[model samples]
Target: MTKGEQTRRFIIKQSAELFNQHGYAGSSLSDITLATGIKKGGLYRHFASKDEIAVEAFNYACQIVGGKIEEAVQKGETSYDKLMAYFRVYEHAAESPPFIGGCPLLNTAVESDDSHPLLRSKAQESSGRTLDGIREIVEQGRASGEFRADVNAEALAMLTLSLLEGGIMLSRLEGSNRPMQLNIESYSSYLKQFCLK
Candidate 1:
């Protein structure tokens, strides 16, 4: 890649944590500049505005998070194992989050719901994609006779995502992993109902 591209990526990489830790409105231009070690002029050269940089930073954060989940999911041979693997990715979120500030989707969704239209849209899109992925896994499991034929993939997927995200939120807020661990443990047992006899 060109030097310019590398610089842009570096900026995104640095700014991603800042954005994730601090909401878009909360993260000022000075914060971005400080995090990236780039002055106003240098930042403006790479990004047209803070909005553009925030969007890119959010996307970059999601990419890193998605990559980690995908890697874990790929290691499982069965759909149940795959779903469990996905949950396991965040098992220690409070202590060792996939990203520095926690789940970007959760953070962005909460912070941007009323204030940032663009970011809210981005979060919605990312959430939809995650739901779709989980739905696909459930469908595959049903097709393979691993899951019960009557399993409601859509609802199950939503529930799974909700449980995981909520768990992350609670865990992070309380500064402990108990909430996440409990959710994972309960979900694992609950998931057994979908298995074929």
Candidate 2:
């Protein structure tokens, strides 16, 4: 890529980290320029406005989270293990600096719900992608005879998404991992009942 394109990506990358830590509303153009050490003109040269950058930043953050989940899925020992790892991925993310403001999708969903329709749509899309991943896993497990044949892939998808997102919110809000830990523990038992021999 050209240097200009590379610089734009770099700005987006850095801005995404900052935006994930601070809400889009809380992240000003000045904050973007300062965090990225790029002047406002330079930022505008790449992104039209802070809202544009915020949108890109949210996309970048979701990419980071999705990458981590994919890595976890690949590292597992079996279909069941991979499904187990999929759930474990969130607990791991909750501890990472990238999730310092908690799940980016959840943060943006709450922050942009009433203000920015586009941003809210992006957040919803991020969640839809993750739920798609969960659905695919459930389908795989069913095909492989790891999960029960009657497993409702879409229902499991929604449950997994709700449990993980809710666990993250509760754990972060309470400043403790107990909620997450307990939730994940329950997840393991649920897996045992549905997926294990």
Candidate 3:
């Protein structure tokens, strides 16, 4: 890549964790500059405004979380296993998140809900992608006779999404991994009862 492209990536890499941890309003230009070791002029050169940088940073954060889920899904041998693996990412979130903060999708969704329209939309799309991933796994499991044919893939996917994200939010709020760990175990149990023979 060109030097300019590399620099832009470097800026995003440096600023992603800051944004994820601080939220859009909380993370100031000074924080970004300090994290990136770039001056205000240099930041403006790469990004037109803080909003622009925030959008990119949010995307970067989401990509990090997505990468972990994707990695887990790839390691599973069956559709049921893959779905469980996806949820397992959250179980391990406190110990090994893709970034410093918790789930970026959840963080961005809550922080951007009323403040940044573009970011809110981005979070919505990210959520939709997550739901789609769960639905696909459920559908695949049913097709393979691993999950019950009577199960509603979309409904189950939505339920799984709610449980996992809610659990993560609670865990982060309470500053304990117990909530998420319980959710993971309960989710796995539900999966075994709902899908596996």
Candidate 4:
């Protein structure tokens, strides 16, 4: 990649962690510069404004989720297993960074609101992609006869995200894993229902 592309990517990568951990509003350009060891002027060379960098950070955050989902489905014996495996993998990764932020989608949703127009759009787009992925997995399960044809794939996708994200929020706020594990168990039970013959 060109130097300009590399710098842009670096800025986004550094900012993703910062914005996810500290929030977009709380993260200043100086924090980014200090973390990256790049000067403020250097950061501006790649991003026009902090808002632009925030948008890019949101995309980077979304990409990590995309990669995790892709990895989770690699070894499933069947479509049903694949769907469940995706959630299970995410459950384990929940303690890891990014996910521990209680989901980039929820984070950005509450943080961006309608104020950060570009960041809000990024959050919306990322969520749409995640929903599409879950639906695709469910569609595959139906094709394999592992899931009922009557199931609402779209609704299930939304539910999966809701359970996981909501659980994370409660867990983070309480600074405990009890809430998270409870939601994981609940989510797994719902997945089991889909696996019924």
Give the candidates in order of lDDT, highest first: 1, 3, 2, 4
Provide C-alpha RMSD values for all models, in order: 0.9, 1.8, 1.3, 2.1
In angstroms, the error of model 2 at 24 is 0.8
Clashes of each: 0, 0, 0, 0
Arranged by TM-score with the best first, the candidates are: 1, 3, 2, 4
Per residue, candidate 4 scores C-alpha lDDT tens digits across 1-197 of: 99889888988888888888899889888999987999988887888898888887887878786777677777777766666665565454345533536577878988889678887888888888878888898888888787887888889888977876777677667777667678878777877876444
TM-score for candidate 4, residues paired by index: 0.88
- Where does candidate 2 stray beyond 4 Å? 92-100, 195-197
Lowest-scoring 10 consecutive residues by lDDT in candidate 1?
Answer: 188-197
lDDT of 1 by residue, 1-197 (tens): 99999999999999889989887888999998888888999999999999999899999999999999999999999999898877799999899999999999999999999999999999999999999999999999999989998889999999999999999999999999999999998888888855543
What is the C-alpha local distance difference test score of each model?
A: 0.92, 0.80, 0.85, 0.77
Which ten residues in a row are the worst by lDDT in model 3?
A: 90-99
What is the Å distance of residue 7 in model 1 from its true position?
Answer: 0.8
Can you list the residue pairs that collide in candidate 1? none
Give the distance in Å from residue 101's predicted Cα in candidate 1 to where it truly belongs: 0.3
* TM per candidate: 0.98, 0.91, 0.95, 0.88
What candidate 1 gets wrong by more than 4 Å, as runs, is: 194-196
